[model samples]
Target: MENKNLIQKSIDTVRVLAADAVQKANSGHPGTPMSLAPLGHVLWSQVMHYNPENPDWANRDRFVLSCGHACMLQYSFLHLTGYKITLDDIKNFRQLHSITPGHPEYGMTPGIEVTTGPLGQGFANGVGMGIAQQYMAARYNKKDYSIFDYKIYTICSDGDLMEGVTAEAASLAGHLGLGNLIYFYDSNQITIEGGTDLAFDEDVSKRFESYGWHVQNLPDINDLDALSEAIKNAQQETGKPSLIKVRSHIGYGSPNKENTAEAHGSPLGKDEIRLVKEKFGFDPDKDFDISSEVSNFYLEAGRKSAENEQKWNELYENYKRAYPELATEYENIISGKFSEEWKEKLPVFDDEKPVATRKASGKVLNAIAEYLPQLVGGSADLSPSTNTVLEAFESFSPKNRDGRNFHFGIREHAMGAVLNGMVLSKYLIPYGATFLIFSDYMRPPLRLASIMKIRQIMVFTHDSIGLGEDGTTHQPVEQLIGLRSVPNMTVIRPADANETAHAWHVAIEHTDGPVALALTRQELPVIDQKKFASAENLEKGAYILSDSEGQPDVILMASGSEVQLILKAQEELKKNNISARVVSMPSWNLFDQQNDEYKEKVFPKAIRTRLAVEAGSTIGWMKYTTDGGDVIGIDRFGESAPADELFKEFGFTVENVVKKATALVSGNK
Candidate 1:
């Protein structure tokens, strides 16, 4: 009991802080934090190694709160430890402009590893972090150097385990033997709606074991010794990820709310808080209470952890001498820069023969894989179809951690989250792929990546009805606009091989957000750089591919496969003695970034009779197509037929485009 008083007091402080913060905010989940306080104290104050002074220390362990609603648990510990967060910040929980938002956000909060509030997202994100640790260890760790040995620790809830993404990530983690990942299931048997018995009841430990994880079930979370031992044992298992299931009361120490849903979401009343504070041996009148003893204990814990980084820094100096090149490369990646010469390795497509943009993307990946070793990825079991394979690399697996190609199976949502987690490492520029139709499954991570402002690539292929024979269910008629709908998300629909190459270049160079390459399965005619504007104009988003002799009567604009149709239609319009300018509008987001002068030059003020033809939804096209202009796009779902047939049926043809241009030119639109 010598150490029990200080540790228990520290855990009790976490509980009271949760209680006080939620009571002040008048909203937010309180019970999960109260219940998991012991786990939080053990993990943050004892088990996890990190210099609170440097939350971003290269080799510091990562902590992901998968049960992000229990963010008070994270926030309380963050404050007590020597992180940037303060008690005042905790008091302002869920308030406007506060770092302590309802859910823990990565960049917003000092200690938060990833922005996680979406259930199960953090669970998958931790798996991605595990993959990153494994990859970095394989890439940088020398025989004696032990660099990149940091582990990923996460706390998930029953709700997290119930989410499908969690299952997908768990299975992949087990398959790859991510022994560095340790997850704690705060099995308080409570959720916001009601008791988990109302919906969820399954053998969670058995399930994780089936997924090949090392499983340990602790009967009580209050038994701090057992929690520490389980974590230690988890670290000892070096071949599989581990899960510790802790049984605990929801609002531990609450007179009436413990083990009840009432405490799970809403704040406990003043009387209840007072009662709990008294029970924990605190001044019953005080709110947001942190006793002197508890504060000193955690402060000392934080100070002691700084030694981990100091030791790692020394080892790093030795590592540099032993592995000079690898050391420089590691430094470059963590600083988020890479050899600019990789740009030269980007293959150029000069052939006039039609080539699928997806195939072009594959060529780009293969051409630069050796030069850009950090550019690692594979498709969601659709590598052959999505063409996301790095041909020269072996699959990343249990035996081969150095492999660049990751077979993320058919789990699209988990793959997106995993990629998010992997990119969290300053070392890997990861990407994932699937059909555009399947992106619906991966929207959470896609949005999270943008929110965190993480730079990664997503190859979304079979972009439109042109994916033929896939039927309406497989074809993505609205996905283009859907992705564009996400703020800060850059969606690039490359018209052909050359444009696709530039899209990848833009994706790598642009560092602010995630870039989705919406590529075509059907072959598109290569736009010759000599005959028209350069494909390099793709960086500008929308460019005048081919122009009219003077101020054209009608302007023709399109993206992806339809660009060829508009080019042909421009000629058709010219044959009819009607002047028309053809514009290749590949990326709306990029084009928006261009100056007004450039936008006006591309869409001249005199050109109101413009026609925008695309194979997908016409939702966001009106910005380019003036009031007098029209858009030829699929307002309905696609059909099961040949790509050519679907294009024709949907009015995505040269004949139809010419007709629309004639009508607009004739003032009949």
Candidate 2:
């Protein structure tokens, strides 16, 4: 067994590096890294199964620092353990272009698993990573070779524990029985303002216990053996996640700022630095010191990691020989390749069999899920209503990781953050669903996913006033526009079932960033093939569903349920001896991606009389509607009545849309 004295020395090594780095940079949170040093050392050196040499190894353990303010502690460990992080990187901490930043970002740093700093995001993400591991192990792991057997470990603080998202994720983790998920709570009893008692005084261990987690308390922060034993106990508990509350003083050994909020952030002054260095038995005059013995100790961990990788490779070779087809799929998933057969499997919609885009979306998801086994997701208590659940797949429960469905309950915010973590794991295609109105609750994670360019899916249903009876609270009036505003985020509001299927088709194939599918609740009439074009044109953003004889005087543009309204208006215009064109604009972002020539061809400038209508906010319609164009849309919150009444009260009738179109045509004439 590693001696307690040796572990304490290692922890001191981590603490001193953090203190020196913060002191040198004249910035950063010193208290967390200083206090959590012993716990981090215990977990990384003794319990965690990560390979510092190959941070991208598929089956290696995942580590997330939920308390991202304490990034220096992670950087110090990475530097000492011989990961890509260097002492120089730590010196340049929080610099403009340096790898070491204020927070731990997934792709930016070598060992960071998820981009964290947003309070409970890292903890929520850890829950997601645990879920991904369970699904991967269930789907691919053979009896002899434990290919996907890995744990997700995270170190969080009072801020992370206090966030509502953390509570939601913890509940879900317990319900799923993610035994491999272990979290180390740094119980320093200090926050930025002062003690946690100021704003957060809840008993964290009891709260986690309520969430069905096995809670353990380590009275001594310096007790490495006890910490390891607690982890062992957690690993042995096959039906519950574990939370270890480590009681420790913030900035332990620091003479002046120990246990004070002053140590939470900001660099210790040069004088205080000298005192800490003297206490750690380091040269007060020198900075960034790593004893030769300490450096050599970490090199052993690197060598052991390489050897473990080699063993896994040999096992995989034998497994490949035994199961060739499964091996090919595994390699493809790891390599981020999808068979063309998967695309061929995507359902094609005919205009004659008009279906609600949400229904089509569900079909597309089911088809893609059949080929891409890594695809795993759930709705925020709206699985059946959102049409996001896979029919044949089982629910992800405490006892079984093989289940495909995720029951997120009512926690939209946590579900979103958890999805981000799963995507960061690189083993599962994570997605979340809820009513479009509830998107406001989950916007933070959604924005973070966009900023990180993570390929996660968000299914938003009950898109507009068409949701009915649920009132303005349930119906989303501005959400579509709000979601569409996010850079690199593809928002698809499918018109009919075929378009919805195509939207999912594009969503799954897109590997760059996040994709959100906005779906409707009501059934839509299927456009006749003889009268309307195929739904494949939906990829163009705006496609002419029905056209006039020649150079139409007016054009009608709409999306989702409103597309049928424009079509009805077009028929009425034709009967009145007026030439009108109907366009279905399913996704404005995808359409903007289309070539300029294609855009102009779809919306001819010659037809200056354009009318756009939808049952949502009008803020986004200015782009489609030109100077002479008119938009018939809801400008304010909807009413608490039936969807049909709301639509009528909101003036979402074909007559109103036709009136706008007729006025534009008359002006053109």
- Candidates in order: C-alpha RMSD to true structure: 1.2, 2.6
Tens digit per residue, CA lDDT, model 1, 506-617? 9977778899999999887888878989899999999999998887888889999889998899888889999889899999999999999999999988778888998888
Model 2, which residues run further than 4 Å from truth? 1-9, 351-354, 574-578, 603-609, 665-669
Best by lDDT: 1
User: Which portions of model 1 show Cα errors greater than 4 Å?
Assistant: none
- Model 1 — which ten-residue stretch has the worst lDDT? 1-10
Model 2 lDDT per residue over 259-349, tens place: 9999988888889988998998889999888877777776676666657677888988898998888889888886789877777888765
RMSD of 2: 2.6
Q: Report lDDT (Cα) of residue 341, candidate 2.
A: 73
TM-score of 2: 0.94
